[model samples]
Target: MSRMRYFTKVEFYNYRADSGGEKAGYYALIFFFYNALIIYLFGLLMYKTDFLERARLYYSNEHLFKLAIYSPIFILELAPLLFLLRSKKENLQSIGLTTSNTAISILLGIVGAIPFTYQIILDFILHKKEIQLEGANLWVEFLILFIFTALPEELMFRGYIQTRITGLIKNKYLAIVVVGLLFALMHIPFQMSMVNMTFMDYLITNWVYMIQLMVMHIYFVYLYTRNNNILVPIISHTLIDYIQLYIK
Candidate 1:
């Protein structure tokens, strides 16, 4: 096997020239803001209201409550992209969904996930965190993480947002950085809702985590761009999240 090109300037330039890069960027921004708004509203509800309590009471099951929350958010995140795909008559392959490079993609996915996996294990060893793995519940959690968290998030950030931004921005590296920042910022509202922290407080305490997230996203972009396959990042992301559960 040969080394894959991380980026191809000519290819990106041609794509931008042919694909209406400006229009794509405009749509990307719209989609991003729309998703952000949805996330913010959901977070606000979760924070201010007894939405979780109500859902837990209604479902009478932890799994059901989680599903109730995550499923809708997943759908909302993908809704605009689905509509764009349909209206534009664009196929999944256009958004890096092809299996053409399955083996390499999977290899890169594992490679990208290694550092996070190592860190998680180290944390478990150093902090003496309990490894909680309820068999059936673990499977359910993995499914939720993969479907709702990894799949939708990678699709939105790496698949749609990053791809469009690459075309719109002249510098591919800068585009990746921009997307990384956007990816990190998108988590703010939800994190705030979860922790009940103000923006400044969250940033003050979690700045390191935010930086780590951005760096990780840059790696994800590299994997996606290297393979031209979204599966690469999705696999890595799913594995990372699933492993984190062990320490959580």
Candidate 2:
């Protein structure tokens, strides 16, 4: 038996295939169907799981803030939904139904970092807000958050549901608007759980944030068009998140 290599080209290719189990539009429908199933199953399970308890060992006002702040932004929830999008790899290379590029990923990451840092600094200078230094294990939580959460969520929503449904409509901007709205609604559970917000609150609060979120989604679309690389968006998203966390 041969020892497994830490990082190999062949292994990377294999993992990429596994990232997208089927063709873009193929899993998109599955994600749409399975998504509801996943919600029912997971929702039922979470309701019974330790996570169901409102008053737990970790419960607090701070935890409320944690929930409200992190839930929609989690991004990983989209993973299960990736089954719903289009693949761009064929436009790039052999069997290249899709490809994940790293260089542009790094560029967007670096770009997103500077502005985030600047915002943090501005907050500090004006003494209007402050970022608490909460102790966290970067590599560990990041793995749990991004790998287990964000990437999958992005794959499912932006990738799966959008592409599949949009294919029928044939209107690009409308497709994004439709999917983005659904993406926002998908977080309703968290919205309901984390805070006592009304319909107006949900719409109003998100309207401001949605602008940035939509822009990020567009950037991912651009990356998809250029390199057929979902990874670029994934990595860009992950790094941008970490940078945001650090800056705050």
Candidate 3:
């Protein structure tokens, strides 16, 4: 395969026998809206309501709370794709789940992650920040970050959304940017809750960060389209989150 390019044409797997650009675009919009709604409602329940406090009364284990939030979202994100696959008799590879380009994909992922990795190292040296795992369960944290956060996200955004958009838009760069914007927008509610910011405040104060997120996702789009392998972006996404969570 040739080296990946920003303007390179993106190839997509045919999830449906009669998959046309218009049809794919329609389903993609539906999936995006569904995901955004789920996230918005969950964020409201977690932060705006007394749901977490009420739940904490019964479940003493703090990990359960994280699991409670992530597990359901993960399942919800994967459900539509799973249902389509089962009904269509399509295999996992239909969403770029195969290990066909495992070695190259991993290499590219690591290569793409180096700059952020260097920044973490620099922070450690300059600020003397201590690297520590957030919880006692190291493997559990890794699994949760990798399986729940990274895998489903890459599968949804890069695998499904980007693929469909690439088909709909002739300009691959435009398609990737559109997916990047959607990816960034999806995080707005959750980020607002984390920072205790109102929607307007978030847009005003964190617009730069939002654009950076979009750029970061654009790279993820490049990674996925580069090798036509979801693992490329999945590995990079997991590694970046792991380092930020554990190291920084």
Candidate 4:
């Protein structure tokens, strides 16, 4: 229980002009690169050990990856930030984890999910394909994606990193864009490994997809800032990702 509180109860790293200097830059670098490293190492572990391949025969590889790789590292990646916040006695509300505006946040989350929902429908219509739920247990997919994938990613990116970066950069707008780019960049390494083509070929082929993800990240940041609630983006992001399962 105490360990859970330590991870879930850390305060936001707020922006103060005097604090947004070299030290902030250092922390920002640690936030992005270090988390990226954790992800990369896990991907390598899954690839080398054939855990992904073996697990896919029984379960959705995506769920397995999140369960076996992303979730654990996500917890580890969050620890130092929590320690820093704890030491400084910062307010967790600044990180957007508050229950202050519960009703409003839910409304905003549903509204924020609309455009993605529209896009998902349009894609199915254009492709002449039905949106079908695939898997042995759909609820398991939901649970994994919601708990391990959506929740952790939101907590790591929107909840902690973005809040901290906003403090460090001193320009909330630039911080959002930079964070969006980092969010996009983090996926590239594993994506490149998944493809058989050369690095240049992979880049050329996936540039559009990369742009889309970065745009999604920007939208997520927008949602987070709009509601000052992490739940807004968490719900938005989870639905967006789950809907992708229906896309061919």
Q: All candidates' lDDT scores?
A: 0.78, 0.49, 0.76, 0.69
What TM-score would each prediction reach against the true structure?
0.87, 0.57, 0.84, 0.77
Name the runs in model 1 displaced over 4 angstroms: 1-14, 122-130, 134-136
Top-TM-score candidate index: 1
In model 2, which regions exceed 4 Å deviation?
Answer: 1-100, 103-118, 121-133, 198-201
lDDT of 1 by residue, 55-99 (tens): 776886778778888888888889889898676556777677786
lDDT value, residue 147 of candidate 3: 89
Per-residue CA lDDT of candidate 3, range 85-191, in tens?
56545567656777777999989987777766778968888999976965558777777888888998898888778766654666767777888889988888877
Of the two candidates 2 and 3, the one with more favorable lDDT, higher being better, is 3
Candidate 4 clashing pairs?
Answer: none
What TM-score does candidate 3 reach?
0.84
What lDDT would candidate 1 get against the real structure? 0.78
Q: What's the TM for model 1?
A: 0.87
Clashes of each: 0, 26, 0, 0
